[model samples]
Target: MVTLRLIAMAALSFLAASGAHATEVKCKGNEAMLTRYLGMFDEVFNGRKLDRIAEYTSEDFQPHDSAPGTPKGHEAIRLLVTNMAKSFPKRKLTNDLIICGGDMVVAYQTVEGINDGPLFGGIPATGKSFNFNWIDICRFKYGKVVERWGAGDALGMMTQMGFKLTPPSAEAK
Candidate 1:
């Protein structure tokens, strides 16, 4: 009787452990997808591979940025990417950190490049390389990136490019 009870308890413990492990595996898989998705930005941006964006993003993916009148959707994203490539012929996006869980991920990145060509923002090429940090939060559904909310230092970037905005005289004092 003692031996039988011990066997039953051991079996129950094994089942519990397996269940926990399975949950962990699922979580890790989601995290991997998030990381891979974030890494693809570097690949697509630097390599000028617009198609890769479709491979990772959903057909109805939405991207929100700090800029007003910014583009959205897959085609818009493609245009944005192409324009970025045109602006910064030597652009490079480096992912600094990625945190993900379940179906959400946040990526912190630093983009460094020289705007030596015309871009959508109409900022002429200063031929000067600048580094700016950005944070993007992406939501995933059905194994595809569905939406993203991004915010970055656009003003800082403009300032770095030698675009000066005179402060209001009242505030200047």
Candidate 2:
């Protein structure tokens, strides 16, 4: 637990220091793209329209915080949405804040759901409920997202799912 807390704290500090300073250019129409992005999330996560995800992402999409071996290219993102639905079938994302600057859009959101299926590279279902917040920064070009960075509350999810972050010395390296 101590380790997880430390990592989350470091990430929070980094985000606070390096956020919202990426550009000085004005984005006049990016708000509409952001709206479409949120709607894409709703459709993929709730409406089960997994086939339409390609409409919102670029051909050379990049994932900044994706799990290892999570594939690459546009299909990787589609796979992620698919896995999210499989793991948290009742997932809900509530957007708290959204800011668009130039071609970038940053959003703060909370995700609440039950983990009743596969997750984290074959971790078995725990059937436990959890609510955690995350931040997603997406960079767009010509209406499609070119890159995205997601910072998720993994510690909260693990604890809620009845897992422990034991000391390294007390366990294996």
Candidate 3:
């Protein structure tokens, strides 16, 4: 009876191990999905192709920034991009670093542009140019980007555009 019990336990252990291995294999991240997401960033920023957002983002896509509200869905993202482009007509984004792990990608980039257009973030453009860095963390599920979190130096950009929080001290006459 003891020998029979040992054999049955070993068989069960083998089955469990095989099941775990199968699940791990199935849950692996798809490289093609990662590549597509990276490419989408290029198209959106460099090519200014806002329409391509729908192709890479999920129907329920959500983007979170340091700002209070979140932008949801492809249409919202498109509108956000359009407004940003209008605010900085000569804006350029350069990817400084891109790292992908599992199903998440983190991108570090720098944006350079002239603030020569209408005001953004309550700060009017002063026709001044500035460069700012930002970091974005994006997650993909089932080959589509489902979520993103972005943060950058909004105050610094405003400062560069000559918007000072405190009134400048009058120069000594």
How do the residues 26-143 of candidate 3 rate in per-residue lDDT, one tens digit apiece?
Answer: 2235557557766887787566698788877899998787355645788667876788887888776766666678888777776767777787556566887666778878898877
Candidate 2 lDDT over 23-55, as tens digits, reads 232235675876766776677545768677787
Candidate 3 runs further than 4 Å off: 1-33, 66-71, 121-123, 167-173
What is the alpha-carbon lDDT of model 3 when measured against the actual structure? Answer: 0.71
Q: List the lowest-lDDT window of 10 residues for candidate 2.
A: 18-27
User: Could you tell me how far off, in angstroms, the CA of residue 113 lies in candidate 2 after the best superposition?
Assistant: 1.0
Q: Check candidate 1 and list the clashing pairs.
A: none
Residue 119, candidate 2: alpha-carbon lDDT: 80
> Which residue pairs does candidate 3 place in steric collision?
none
| 2 or 3, greater by TM-score | 2
Q: TM-score, each model?
A: 0.70, 0.76, 0.72
Question: What's the number of clashes in each of the models?
Answer: 0, 1, 0
Tell how far residue 76 is off in model 1, in angstroms. 2.3
- The local lDDT score (0 to 100) that residue 91 gets in candidate 3 is 79
